[model samples]
Target: MKWDYLLFYRWLALNMVGFAILWVFHMNGMVEPVFLADSSYIVYVIAGLFLYGMVLCGFRVWKTSRELNWVKRGDKGKLKEFADKSRQSDRESVKEAFEIKLFARISFVKYISSSLVMLGLLGTVIGFIMVLTNIPANAVGDAAQVGKLVGALTNGMGVALYTTLVGAITNLWLNANYNMLRTGVVNLIAAILESADPQ
Candidate 1:
């Protein structure tokens, strides 16, 4: 498959399919929404951040794909243009662009992966705090009252669990994309070097 094709669109479809199905289940009441919005809407905020991270990664991928196309064309003149490090005056700098778009930042994939986990952990801790604050359910007052408390606690735990699951799955999803992106980048670099010095 072409790197340009897979770099942005295919994985976007995968994510849409995967997450849409999960959302359908959630909408149908087969699964919970992670946040009731009454207690803590932070889950939604984290999710939004995650989506933004994906966009950043997507931008980086799109930029890299452009460079990959340049490499595949095997344009010696362009390579010379780009490879010249000590250009006295040039507006478009290849080294600078490469560093920004490909090499250094990881497309924000690593950050998203780590941040997803942290967000999940934070949600879980908040859930635990919810349970802790309502600990009077275990105080052994009335049997019916205790049963209701247990149910409430169970629901709280469900929120924590679902958030954790979502975070993990999101990381896995992005990670798969990251691997493909890295492979494409490495290939592009090798192809550019080869094209630059065709022996």
Candidate 2:
């Protein structure tokens, strides 16, 4: 039986890397690109998705860790009590299992991660349009307008890329940890059940 501690360490390292990137961006004043309509939406959407994912992952980790600790106590009687409690109602059991498998499934992460990238692409397209619309037509103040438009475009692109990176990295780390924790949970439960059964 492979231990989950090592995998958890790897997950922590990856999470730290994601945080470091975000900190750097924040320190550089790139956290929220100066409020352009298109650019702002892109950042807001991606941040929302990643934040939701983080919360979901955190819940999975907390519940599984608590169960794993109990199982590791090697108290067969306690294990049987837990299993009985877990099956209190068919509907509740089904809901719990669904939550576990949902977190464990890598596809969930992929979908959100891809969505972040698409959001970035969409931002890029809008940013391009904004810049093109500002093209100078030999007007006296046209050059200044062009510069502002170009700056907005750059900011939009930057937010798009950074958000995508953060989302992907977070999803990857969470998925890896989910699998490791899930395996540990299943193993511990099985052992407890077997020991609790009367010979």
lDDT (Cα atoms) of all candidates against the true structure:
0.66, 0.57
Instruction: Give the poorly placed runs of model 1, Cα more than 4 Å off.
Output: 1-6, 23-28, 75-82, 86-101
Candidate 1 local distance difference test against the native: 0.66
Q: Mind sharing the TM-score for model 2?
A: 0.53
Per-residue accuracy of model 2 over 139-161 as CA lDDT, tens digit each: 33676566665665566555555
Best by lDDT: 1
Q: Write the per-residue lDDT of candidate 1 for residues 1-199, one digit (tens) a residue.
A: 3555455566577668877987888889864445562255656766787788777777767766666666676544335555664254442465557445555656468778778877777777877777777757445677757766886687667657766766777777777767767776776666665665537
* TM-score, every prediction: 0.75, 0.53
Candidate closest to the true structure, highest TM-score: 1
- Model 2 ranges with Cα > 4 A deviation: 1-21, 28-38, 74-114, 128-163, 166-170, 173-199
